[model samples]
Target: MTHDAHSALLHAALDAAERGWHVFPLRPGTKRPALHGEQRCPGTGPCASGHRKWEQRATTDPDRIRATWARAPFNVGIATGPSGLLVVDLDVPKDHSSSDTPDGATTFAALCERAGHAVPATYRTRTASGGEHLYFTAPPGVRLANTARTVAASVDTRAWGGYVVAAGSTTSTGPYEALCGPEAVAVPGWLLSILRPAPKVSEAPSVATMGQSRRYADVALAREAQTVAGAVHGGREAALFRAARALGRFVAWGDLSRHMVEQALQEAGEAAGLTVAECRSTLRSALNWSIAHNQRRRTA
Candidate 1:
């Protein structure tokens, strides 16, 4: 990309960010190439040594992290990753309606709410002439296209000022507007209200009784690490590290509960050729036995 083109892209990205759209910057070497040789990076700051500055910023001022959505003249993009969703592209008709809006935003918001957060509306500059990039949060764990379809179902592309851009395409920047702010129009509340159902809160499980469950899971994960460590010759340690990291992320995201934690560990142990079923049975018995013992003691 020429310097002028790069500069133009940067300005459009900044405009999106200002409007509460999270923007990823794309640069050379900062990301692994997609199938077609295009790469995605954060739009903020410098790209050096293939490390994106936004990654570091995310560690600190995470609010500035771009939501998983993108908009362009001819395409729209959404992110589907463990960390969060992001919009990568935007382009559609200006007159859109509730039935024709993008599904990515609704799904993204729903997932974020489940994970105890909210998704914000984000916009970007269109690659097309005098257009703007618009995006919404995507649901965690779902494929990007799925989320996009969800948004599209509820929105009427012709009624609103935009249309749902196809995924994996590029848009021109000439027609895009580079300004987004509080005054910018958002997905109306009535539409959002109808599209996304409220999340249900479940009763909390007993923590004391859950201790054994958690411990069992931890032990299983540790054992799995040991096995992965053994199998991978030169990178056994690295394999273990990766497993540990995955576990940590699961825990951080609150996806692993006492029961599920144990199951995860058991899976890990099985992967390592350990006696997973035996360990799991033993753990279950010990926990049940302990719970009975505790009840007896309390009554006495």
Candidate 2:
């Protein structure tokens, strides 16, 4: 029985590879990656030169797939970016029984209906949790990144830096199985417009502005950003957190917009060589903590 399940898993990985999707092993019966993380890496084999992330090491090689799956009945993961595919994940509510909250499919359908277009027909998967994944071929020369709750409630997307569980993979809940699609269709222009980010307006330091409080906020934003930008590698995350926490009050007090503040700090953090994920996580947590604590104190 074990060998049979192992063979089945190997076939599943090969199937995803046949579709030209980069494949990796997910831990058996779980959605997480099975690859060793950087901290735990012995710096041997694939990591001899450097620690290659699962995304970097995901492969279409049948021999590698067979060798990997032969070790165990691992679940399959498709690295969406390397596969040149953008996957729209329509998820069920957190509780899995929340009738009051609409699932991702419902919200996405409403978005499409409002835009006067039907959901694009393409490769689709039915997830174990009764949700769906719509696969679309990304347009040439365009790169998108992972997003959560940006499209709509419960609707998320995976492009670069993301992966999806392949159809043949199984979880404790149920099996992930392909629903339909002769093949993945090209993404619609309407959807692309939504996924693409707005071109950034240049943010100059120390710009002229009116109003005493507004001027104070502007100066503070610039100074804090400068601090983050000058932070060394070892101190970048802490500097970003401090800057964001300091600026969050200005946002809560309505002296500055949240978007502008986030953008400024993000740019500064990145300039200091912090990873995008690190900057985003630090900024979000710091800002949230500041805003929530201040709001509560104000009410009290």
Candidate 3:
């Protein structure tokens, strides 16, 4: 990267940090983190006491930001959870096959119209793919989890356990540029109502304690996990995706616990030589699709 490019990215990190957003380094020209994973933890410096994940490693300290960005022209990422942000990601579909589906921007606009409120203007960024990101501040005392397409078709959210590429970062396609406010407005109440998950009524049954009839779910889980674990090297991610989608029906039916199924498949995916990040992304997307499409209600 040129000196100007390096300076631009460094300023981006510093700028995000200036807004009180916890910032971290993404690989140059990529969204992936530049930091080493747990498997490669050196157990020195920041991890001198213990290994801190990227989320934990994210910082708002200017000194730390400058020190880290000095080494390379790394892109900037904002840890949404620590920064108390809830960003709505409006995404465009890839390829021509899914042309019928409306883009996230359209769907979100429709949702806003139906909700009887104009889209609340907030800090907005234009993503590299020509989609928009509307940044919102989380309401105090309310902790929201990241969601995929929960708000509307093609609309996903980032909260805890999620991060967004900040403005000034560049990808092969284009740069993520800020179009609006430096301060993200508070999350609109109407939007929050849709994003929040309903309160749990009862705990899901564990694998060992499942009733005889529900045992089918456990059997299916084991079978799918096996398929994922033993998948061919080239098709491991696809296998993991298929397994997660297949078991999603069981989770949607409430015959299987989502947590249990995720853990099983995650272990299998890792065992099959997939990275933890790869497994999580695929697993989350697949399961979200399955659960949303196949929801089942328990007897009263």
Candidate 4:
């Protein structure tokens, strides 16, 4: 990297730290972890901690950031989950030319269409290889696991257990450029459902312990309903459907009564401006869908 590029990266790292984002160093011009050794690293594989365990050692301490970046112009890696952030990485194929139509762009557009909502305006970064990273504040409760090509081919998630190369980090192709700087937005309900599916039902707890367990379960289910309630917008019906479906899971597990779940959905939907008819229709559809979904899981 050039002296100018090095300065740009260091400045970017500091800025991220100031924003309370946990930042770590990647090997200069590469995505590998800057730290390496037999002891400091832990793992059994070649690309594990011994060489590129970047995610494990990522930190936000200013002193550590300053010391690491000063020794060499290292690329910046942001610890995603630790920072309460999630990133969608839309990537172009490595063999593709920079000017080619980006796969990420095409798939993301399709994703927006399917969700019945436009992408929320927030912080975005243009990657060195002509891809993009859409940043969002991670939702509570669900463990958004990192996955590759799950949303679409070439589209991946850097969730709670992953890291993303920060904007301004330099690579062989070029620097990761910040395209937008707004606060990270919430992940839409449609997107969230795809990233983290509704939990499956489990065997019922003993009847002897039902009283205490039911109280705890009700509180948990109520919180999940609130998560759904937040999904009120252009896709209000779809969002409610997701919420109702989640509630249905509790019913299936015998932790919540169907009447209780329906009451919760009705109240939340009405408060969110949904009509009585719409809420009922959504609830019925969600229950049916949940039943079918569970059947498929059981058979499979």
Candidate 2 C-alpha lDDT tens digits along 217-289: 7888999999999986445666777778778877886778999999999999999987798678768866875
Worst 10 residues of 2 by lDDT: 199-208
Candidate that would win on lDDT: 3
* Model 4: number of backbone collisions: 0
Tell me the tens digit of each residue's lDDT in model 1 across 94-145: 4556556544335434434432344444443333433344444444332222
Better of 1 and 3 by lDDT: 3
Candidate 2 error regions (>4 Å): 202-300
lDDT of model 2 at position 82: 93
Task: Provide the lDDT at 216 for model 3.
Answer: 65
- Candidate 4, run of 10 with poorest lDDT: 291-300
Indicate the worst ten consecutive residues by lDDT in candidate 3: 199-208
Model with the higher TM-score, candidate 1 or 3? 3
Worst 10 residues of 1 by lDDT: 73-82
Using lDDT as the yardstick, the better of models 3 and 4 is 3
Quote each prediction's TM-score. Answer: 0.27, 0.68, 0.68, 0.62
List model 3 lDDT by residue over 157-237, tens digit each. 999899999999999989999997757999876677545544342334432334743676777788889998997655676
Q: Which ranges of candidate 4 are over 4 A from the true structure?
A: 1-3, 37-53, 93-102, 203-300
Better of 1 and 4 by TM-score: 4
